[model samples]
Target chain A: MYKLIWHMAWNALGRRRGRSLLVTLMIGASLWGLLFMEGIYDGMTEQMIDNTVKSDSGNLSLFAQGYRLDPSLDRLLPDSLLNQQILRTNPLIKSRSIRFSHTGLLATAHAARQVQIQGVPLEEEIVHAGLSDKLAQGRLHFGSDGNGAILGHGLAGKLRVSIGQKIILSAQDRQQNINSLVLKVNGIIRSGNQPIDDKILYMDIEQCREFLGVSQGFSQLSLILHNPDNTALLQEQLLRELDDSAIEILRWDQLYPALLQGRQVMKTFNLICNLLVFCVAGLGVWGVMTVSVLERLREFGIMIAVGTSFQQIRAQVLLESTLLGLGGFILGAGSGVATLLWFVEHGLNLEVFQEGLQAFGMDTIIYAIIRPDYFTTALIAILLACTASVILPLRRLKQARPVTILNSQ
Target chain B: MDAFIEIAHLHKTFETSREVSTPALIDVSLTIPHGDFAVISGPSGSGKTTLLNLLGALDSPSKGTISLGQTMISKLKEAELSPIRRDRIGFVFQTHNLIPVLSARQNICYVMRLQGRSQQEQESRVAELAGKLDIEQLLDKHPDQLSGGQQQRVAVARAVASRPQLLLADEPTASLDSTNAERLLDLLEQLNHDEGVTVLISSHDSLVINRARHSIVLRDGRVVADHYERNDIP
Candidate 1:
């Protein structure tokens, strides 16, 4: 029975080919635009969050409780705390980078800038964060003497310095006395993190400790987890089990709430966009179905009079709309997936807006993220829209009496 | 003769607007006996169509009763009336009203399919009706592809394919030429005699009125004549 009804509906749609094709294309084009926007925007957000996590804040960061508020040389995380068994032996800790961070004036022959000088072990930094991959110029090595510095590109551009140039870094020591050291610019890195790229200067940790007259203590221990999803669970476990009350463990989201908020806002915006597009597509379908029903009143009347129940007619109408919607959905989803796949492979290079993109801490090239849920959500939404669109038309059909239609002729 | 359809003082009014009403049928009482080839003949606006509509269960009379077989159908709700219409009565409209999308074969088999007949049954019925109605060659064509006469024959085949007890046709010949009109009447008479199906039609065509086994004439929404030309069943 359903097969016969479907055949009838299919033939009816074919009778008005132009109108049917027009509605299908309208829905297809709208869905394509929606899918493209959602994929690219999500890609951009995730990339920004990824950059921050890799370059500066790992999945979790441990700091002296008062150090973030004060950042003084006196508030360093003690050596004993840094040497704890869990910090070194816990399976959840994939890698850890010990860093001494201090505020300093970085001076070149032509210019100077105030920067956050970070002292890190170059080998561990590479293993922990793939730091070598972010190098924009020069080599990742800091020379054999360990007196070499890796400058953030923004800071380099500001200081007008280049690889192999000399720079002076000055900061207060633990003794409250100002000290200075000279370092060679060995490399430059661009991590796509605006704050870090604009203000960071990296050097050898031992040299930095000697320059600041600090020994056996570090400011922060950034720990990357084997599974990032375990960050919260590990943090909770640590908070409950650790004997030390002076150390604080913070997740990436807590340390950078803005990125998380940006991700959430984009999600809401995509949802609204999906709603708006599907609603308009649904209206287009309703218009076509309503017109089709009105034009066929006599035919429907004759069917009703001859024993075709209203329920059957209603099913036929619903099937017609669903076929139209599904046609559009297949077209849109096929093209959408193809386009996203291409972009994922080649990346959407917007080098024309590099400066503007950089200002938002984004890369010029954005690769789209293709998720399974996008297609499923669209399928469900289109089905619902198709179903909802037929309500009024079905009502109109039900109210049109067979007698009136036959008599009118 | 046993009455297949019994009508008692049927009345139908159309409310044109809030301030006015028009009477289409008034105090119409008639009986159509089983296996009777009947015609309701009248001038335009004489309620022939309205009376047929009431008998077919397409519309309810404003004030009166209609009994088809043993059921009082005038008071039945729309949903309840559907089964009676489907299994007990069939309607052929003035226009062919063949579902424009389906081929003549599919259209003829429509009601049978709705009745949940087996595929073999539907196919055999279609073959039998196509041969009888001379629509065998046109079965593969859609309604738009067939002529007015051919379309009407297909419509007739569709109406009776479900083996309804009563068949009602409203102005079935009004749109056809004389030759097509004669052929349609011949098929109607043949079905009525061979299948014992009580056929009722509303028309002013002289050829149709003259051929009826029984005729009812209406004027000004009231019946003026109820005459039976041949009362003996074959």
Candidate 2:
């Protein structure tokens, strides 16, 4: 019975190759649309995590309790040695950075934009801040004279400051004294983040201490863990080691609510795109099945009269639908992956939208990233859509009577 | 002779969209002895086909008792009716109705396969039937490749391939020329005589009515005349 039904299905498909191919292509295009959006979402989220962890917050951060809200000099960590020891003892903490951050005056020929000055050990900052790799011009030099600073590219443009140009930074210390220093812009960095690009200034730890009037004290310590999801484990271990009164641990989500919110918006946008794709694909399935059923009514009637049971006939139709869906998914997945790989290797240049994207805090260039799970999900969705479309036709099959069908002519 | 098929008090009616009921078959009863060649004659829309469908178990009468062999078919469900058709009944249609995608041999062997007959048995039976029908040379030909007569011969072979106890034919020679129609009826008569297979055919052709061993005439959904022949006329 199965063999007979299969033969019938095969013959039916062969008899109408052009229509079958058209349906398959429709299904394939739908799958490709769904997978392409998913790939972009996956790629963007991954890039966000990488940029956040490698360039700024190292997966997680430890800050004094009130420092996140105030971000003032008075919220400086009393002691850095205990937190450093705690971080070092935890094997999950792959690397760590201790820094003092404050908003202060930044002067250049073009402008004097208020900037967030991050003070860190020059060598440590180079390794953990993703700063050393982003130099747009000149070199990073933490001279022993304590008079050098790194400016973000966008900030440098606004400041009209170039390499070897003099800039002044001013801030009040924890002791309530106004401290000022003159510094040379040793380098310009481009981090691809609009906020970071416009407001970041980096300097040597000793120089920052002198400018901020902080004597050997740090405000926050950021740790890069091997796995960011192990936040609970790392927090527990750090609490056990550090005196809770002097030190506090802050996860990245708490430290960057805006960034997290932005990510959530992007996720919701992707979900909407996914829903649209599903709807379009499901409609394609329904359209194709309905048309095919109508076109093959005579064939179906003949099969019924030939003693094929309703259940067997329905199974045959479902099998054909499933095969079509599987074929489409294979083609669509292949096309989507190929397109993503091409984009990943050669990113799409959005020079036309550069200004607008910059206004929205996004990069002009976009790269599509393909993930294994996205492909799996797309395939399952296609199969489900195909199955769902065939249900109506299968029900129709149950009510079909051979006598009525044969007499229709 | 023992009745091989008995249909008692059969009634069937169809309702149209305007809510008017039209009778297709009414109080029609019939009995045929084993190995007898029976012809049901009627005008267009006179319900001969309806009675044939009821007897073949393709449909149930609205009210009647139909017995094939020892089984009461009127109360049987569609699922149960299919196996009875597969194993006990053979059908030949007016237009030869061969599935165009399959070769003549495949069409002939289809019912035997449905009956779970072995491949060897199917092959032997198909060969014998096709040879008897003079279509052995055309077994591999598709329906479109055969003439009207050849197509009907394949249909006849298909009908008897499973060696059914009864054969129900609906205008088996309706599409054929007189020569081909005569040839097909002759083949059906030979099968009835040689295999002891009871034959009931619904046809309007005068040739078929004159040749059959038993005749039942229908008019306006009711049987008006029934006759039996004393001698075989080939």
Candidate 3:
């Protein structure tokens, strides 16, 4: 009996080729637009978060309790923290980099700007953040003399200094004495992080320590965990074991709340888009089904009078709507998956908006992420829409009097 | 003879959205015996269709009781009436309301399939009915592909294919040419004598009325004449 009803539903849809095709394509086109928009927007958001994590904060960062607020050399995390057992033996910590940062004046022959000078161990910095990949021009290595410096592309642009140019960096030492050092630019980096690309200049840690006369302390220690999901767990364990009075532990999201908010906003936007597109698709299904049922009132009446139960008729109508929805879903999902796969392999380049993208800490090329839940959620939503779309029509069918329907004929 | 359908003081009214009232069937009482070939003749709005609809359990009467065999159907809910309608009654409409999407064979086999009959049973019954109605060649055609007579024949086949104990046809011959009308009357007669299926048809045509073994005449929603001729069966 079910097979017969299914066959009938299939035939009914096939009979009205134009209307059925119109509805199927309408749903397909809307779903395609929705999937493409979601994939690309999410890609853009994830890329922004990834850049912030890699170019600046690792999964987690540690600092002196008051250093974030005052950012002075006096609040530096003592070098002894590096010898902590968890820092060296814990498997959760993938790699760690110690950074010394201080606000200083950078003066070139033609231009001068105030920038943050960051002292980083070159080999460890490369392993932690793929620093070499950020190099836009010149070599990533400093000279054998350890006097080479790398400027953020934005900072380099402001000073109009390319590789091989000599620049002077000046900052107050730990003894309250002013110190200045002359360094030649070795590399320029564009990390696509707004703060990093706009205002930071990197130098060798040993060179910076010698120049500033800071022999034993570092400002911050950033840890990259093997599994980023374990960051909070490690933070919790560290908080229980370490002296929280002297050091503050912070996750990447805490350090960059705006990036987290950006991700949330994109997610909500995608949800709203999904609701709107599927609602319209549901309405499209409703419109076609209502017309189909209304036009067949006489036939339904005859069916009812001949002992075809109202339930059977209802089943037939529901089956028809479901078939149409499935047709649209298959078409839309096929095209959507293909498009996402292509974009994943070869990223979508938005280089035309390079400056705008950089301002938001987004890379010029974005690779899409395809999760299995996307297809499952869409399938469930579409089936629900198809089922909900037929409720009114089925009620109308049940209410229609067989006598009146038969008599009208 | 045992009563196949019993009606008592049946009344049906139609009310418009504006609170206007019109009566479709008045306080009429009647009894139809098993295997009787009957006709209800009346002018339009005289309640012939309304009477057949009530007997078929397609609609409820405004007042009184209708019992098909022993079950009181007038007060039953639609869900309860569905099984009675499906297993005990079959209907043929003037427009031949064949489902447009289904081929003639599927249409004829629809009700039996709904009853969960075996595939072999549905096929054999469809084949037998197709042969009887001279629709064997047209079995593969959809309703739109067939002529009016062919479609009406298919409708009759669909109506009787399940072998319902009671068959109600409203103006079954109203749209047919005289030859087709005569052929349909002949088929109904064969079912009545051979299958013991009680047939009730609403019609105003003299050709249909003259062939009935029992006749009821209505006017102004009231029965004015009813009589029985000699039974040809038994």
Comparing chain B with the reference, what is the TM-score for each candidate?
A: 0.96, 0.94, 0.96
Superposed model 1: Cα runs more than 4 Å off: A407-409, B177-179
Q: After superposition, how far is residue A50 of candidate 2 from its true place, in Å?
A: 2.9
lDDT for each of the candidates? 0.88, 0.78, 0.88
DockQ for the candidate 3 complex? Answer: 0.77
TM-score of chain A of 2: 0.92
DockQ of 2: 0.45
Q: Best candidate per DockQ, number?
A: 1
lDDT of 3 by residue, B1-234 (tens): 789789999999988657798998999999999899999998998999888889888888999899898899998988888889889998887778888778899899988888999999999999888887888899999999998888989999999999999999989898788988998899899998899999999999999999988999999999998888766633
Predictions ranked by DockQ, top down?
1, 3, 2
> What order do you get sorting by lDDT, best first?
3, 1, 2
| Fnat of every candidate, listed in order | 0.78, 0.18, 0.82
Per-candidate TM-score against the hidden true structure? 0.97, 0.92, 0.96
- Model 3 lDDT vs. the true structure? 0.88
What C-alpha lDDT does candidate 1 achieve relative to the native structure? 0.88
